[model samples]
Target: MLYPNSSSFTPTPFTLNGIPGLEALHAWLSLPFCSMYVIAMVGNCGLMYLICREEALHQPMYFFLSVLSSTDLVLCSCTVPRMLFLFWFNLREIDFSTCLIQMFFVHTFTVMESEVLMLMALDRYVAICYPLRYSTILTNPVIVKAGLVTFLRGAVLVIPFTFLTKRLPFCQSHVIPHTYCDHMSVAKISCGNIKINTIYGLTVAILIGGFDIFCISASYTAILRAVMSLSSAEAQYKAFSTCTAHISAIVVSYVPAFFTIFTHRFGGHTIPHHVHIIIANVYLLLPPTVNPIIYGVKTKQIREVVVRLLGGKRGY
Candidate 1:
């Protein structure tokens, strides 16, 4: 509900439309969605296992990867099951509070993951720019603190927006067009003026996602400078090589997300709502699905551990 004047008709329960204008293709669409979901779960779980099992992998970088995997697991889980149900069975009735809860989780994990990426940039910064002090700087206690702080930031930022939907009384429509309950989609149904919510939500997104991008860029800049200062080109190449996976992970994570959000807001009525929904889901799904693959192929330590794990299982 989102208007200055409430409509005579009240929303009974919100419905998730599950990608507007794509009803006929739901069954076919489910194949790819389910495949990606399984891959995300298996890949992230496998990474988590490798990180936890290999004592040598117990470092600040892997610690951040652990957080990322956990966050991605939760992130995809928040939306995928419900989306599959919608695509397969067409069961879309979600109570108002349930919708709010979903929105909260989807947004919370998004911010949490964003913050973790920012922390990772910091990790690389310290490892490269201050190699001598890397261990001391990102020691166990400090790593734990970084994680706690990331969690607190996401919780504090997102918990309030969960209630923002409560302020809107939806007399217009209860059907959300996206695969999941999203803040703006939920607000758009309200008959009330949602400028405040819009502005505040935008502010929070920028503060979290935007700030992270800026800091990450700065950290990498310093890292490049540090790498360049190395005496030999081989040393410099190795140093830069170590950051390649992280840089790839960061780009994949943030760029599409930013593009999706931007197109959603500025693309105007010319773009179809279905396009918006797809982009939104892509933003949420792509990073988690892609991250482990990137690391598995790019990070030598993780690659070796996974190969060993698979080889040992083959032996059995």
Candidate 2:
């Protein structure tokens, strides 16, 4: 479904090829897809609300978690509503400019999410490896500055990368083989030399996301070393325990994501288009839908607040 045409082109509206070969099953598919989006919206929203309401969650780790929740909400928002509509009502027509804008937000938010995760890892590293200086290092203004820098970094890079369409021609079928517009999916449709596009995209992926992953890994290595050096078993357990939610979040966010990426980069014509699209959807859907559950189950403070909130509702 990565359609790179062999001829010259003209600009036109694009029809999203929503779940090809699965058109007959769209009605059935919409149910779970809609459910996931709803859960994602509510779960992420609830987490943000709880963090804002509970004064105890104002620490650097929780602040990063809140940023992650916001990113997840926006990322899901970029695709899910339209995706649901595409599945159920078949509203797949998207004009060129709008497509570029949507692609900008989607990619930017994704970059922001990855940055926030790395920051969270750094926060954990500092807390574990150098606890006494955690407050001095990650004060309120520092967290705010980190967020602004993250947003600007993603915005600056992704906008230029996405707007690469202005230089190419689109004489091909306006049918994109994915639910929502992606940078590569959109770029590959152009009838011009796409070598530049592909190279730039891969560079952005490697530099932004790949580099962040390396930093996160290094941070965790330091955290583990510091944790192991603690003489008290209880101290070691406590330090490691703080990272349980973050580790769960990383797993849920990255595992399906890498699978989706592999399908895009290497699956070629051999893999089913619907499988690629579904896996892509899953990669985006799971984090927002499941992260709140992970933190709720892992973080004692979050679990306590959630329990109290539910119990209060029951009393009503």
**Tens digits of per-residue lDDT for model 1 on 70-158?**
99999999999999998889889898778889999998899999999899888989998888999988889988888998988898898
Residue-wise C-alpha lDDT for candidate 2, range 7-108, written one tens digit per residue:
235455788888878988988988988899899889989999999998987788888888999999999998988988888888989987788888899889
Number of the top-ranking candidate, with TM-score as the measure: 1
Where model 2 places Cα greater than 4 Å from the true spot, the runs are 1-8, 311-316
List TM-score per model, in order.
0.95, 0.93
**What is the C-alpha local distance difference test score of each model?**
0.86, 0.84
